[model samples]
Target: MMKLREIAHSRTGDKGNISNISVIAYKQEDYETIKKSVTPEKVKAYFSGIVKGRIIVYQLPNLWALNIVMYEALGGGVTRSLSLDTHGKSLSSLLMDMEIEEEENEAN
Candidate 1:
């Protein structure tokens, strides 16, 4: 197994109670592995404790990235939330910690 960070990097953004995260592959060839391994269900489950609503994933093959939209994930938006990470900027870092199967070539 390999961590998502091994092949990709992520960026985070927010609006109201929603969190938008984009996972971009470091190499175009690895995009397929990321797409197959990182599903909306998996992302939802990963942040199950924090996100209270539905999740949506949009594929951008040309960009080699996945855009994940998480609803009700900011604990009621930045100004209203009591959490330190109300903006959820650190979410990208947290997501990179998720484990996934390594690419076939990397297993050798």
Candidate 2:
């Protein structure tokens, strides 16, 4: 087993009360592993405490990435939130902590 960070890197962005997290695999071959492990349901459950709305996962096969959009995630819009990480920039790192089963087929 290994953290998702081992195979991928992420970026986070926010608009209104929503957050978008992009997970891009380091190698094209790892895209399948990411797709299998990082689902909308899983992400929503992972951020259940912080996010109050739905999670959407979009596949970007061309870039070997997944774009996860979380709605109503921020306490409020960035300007109105009291949380230290209002913009959710660090959310990616938080997500990178997610554990995934490493398969023999996974790219190095």
Candidate 3:
């Protein structure tokens, strides 16, 4: 197993109750591995406790990145949320911690 952070980095943004996170690969060659491993369903399950709505993933192959949009994830936005991370800035870190199966060659 390998953590997503081993080959990628992430950034996050928020609007209302929605959160947008971008997972970017350090090398274009690793983009396929990230794409194969990181699915919307997995992301939703990983954040099930915090995300109340649906999750959408957009693949940006040219940029070697994936855009993850999650709804109702902010506990009611920055103004209304009682959680410490109202803006959800720390979500990217949480996502980076997700473990994925390493490619066969990489595991060797």
Candidate 4:
């Protein structure tokens, strides 16, 4: 799971659901490394059951940063399929709290 540490938080226009979140490094000097940590597969695992949309990422030029946009992930596409759960927290923050589990598989 990805560790989602909250940086900035903003709610969508409806204010009923949907949110815009930005996250930075939880640990010092790990910005670049951390940014690289957020892979699509990791997002799947970190979000687990609550997520249901396309995740997009944009890398900032000349900076150790990545901007992620999770589309249609809020309220399960606004069709009553997604519940306003998650405890009213930024998804990025939620992701900040997760740590990717590393394995000991050796390279050939």
Candidate 5:
């Protein structure tokens, strides 16, 4: 097992109560591993407490990235919410902490 952060980096953006996080693998070869582990269902489950609505995962094979769009996930919009991480800037780091089973190679 390994933390997602070990293989990928992320950036986050927000609009209203939605947060969009992009997870980019450090190596192109790692993209497939990330794609297998970082599904919308998995992400939603990982952030279940904070994500009250739907989660959407968009694949960006060209960039070796995955964009996870979480709807109604901010507790409320930044302007209306009193949460410390209003814009959810800290969410990216939080997401990177998710653990996943590392793929085994046949060569092993």
Candidate 6:
């Protein structure tokens, strides 16, 4: 299973309940694999079963990586968790659970 290292994470905005997340490769070389793994479609798929919101993906030219921002996920500004909730879903868990198609892997 592929593993992702969380480089940074934070809320979407001061009052919004959304989660904006950033992650990178544990090993810099893994950036290619990570880029191959994460796509706009994959980002949408990642949050499909667990979160209800809009997911935006952008490529980081400088880093050869990607970033996904989950908007309006925490039920707007009404609810926020204090504990594990403070942390979005585990990066490792998300990567492990992903279903990467064979064709995509082959293209990489």
Given candidate 1, what's the lDDT at residue 76?
Answer: 93
Off by over 4 Å in 1: 106-108
TM-score of model 5 (CA atoms): 0.97
TM-score sort, best first: 5, 3, 1, 2, 6, 4
lDDT (Cα atoms) of all candidates against the true structure? 0.94, 0.94, 0.95, 0.50, 0.94, 0.53
Q: What TM-score should be assigned to candidate 6?
A: 0.56
lDDT of 5 by residue, 1-108 (tens): 999999999999999999999999999999999999999889988998999999999999999999999999888888998899999999999999999999898698
* lDDT tens digits by residue: candidate 4, 25-55: 5444545555666666676666656556666
**Using TM-score as the measure, which candidate wins?**
5
Residue-level lDDT for 22 in candidate 1: 95
Alpha-carbon shift of residue 9 in model 6 (angstroms) = 11
lDDT of 6 by residue, 4-95 (tens): 43422122332366655554555565566666766757776766754477777666746655666676555444355543544454533454
lDDT of 1 at 65: 98
Which is the better candidate, 4 or 6, if ranked by lDDT?
Answer: 6
Clashing pairs in 2: none
Residue 18 in model 2: lDDT: 92
Model 3, TM vs. native:
0.95
Residue 81, candidate 5: C-alpha displacement in angstroms: 0.9
Looking at candidate 4, the ten consecutive residues that score lowest on lDDT are 7-16
User: How far out, in Å, is residue 90 in model 4?
Assistant: 3.2
Note the clash tally of each candidate. Answer: 0, 0, 0, 10, 0, 0
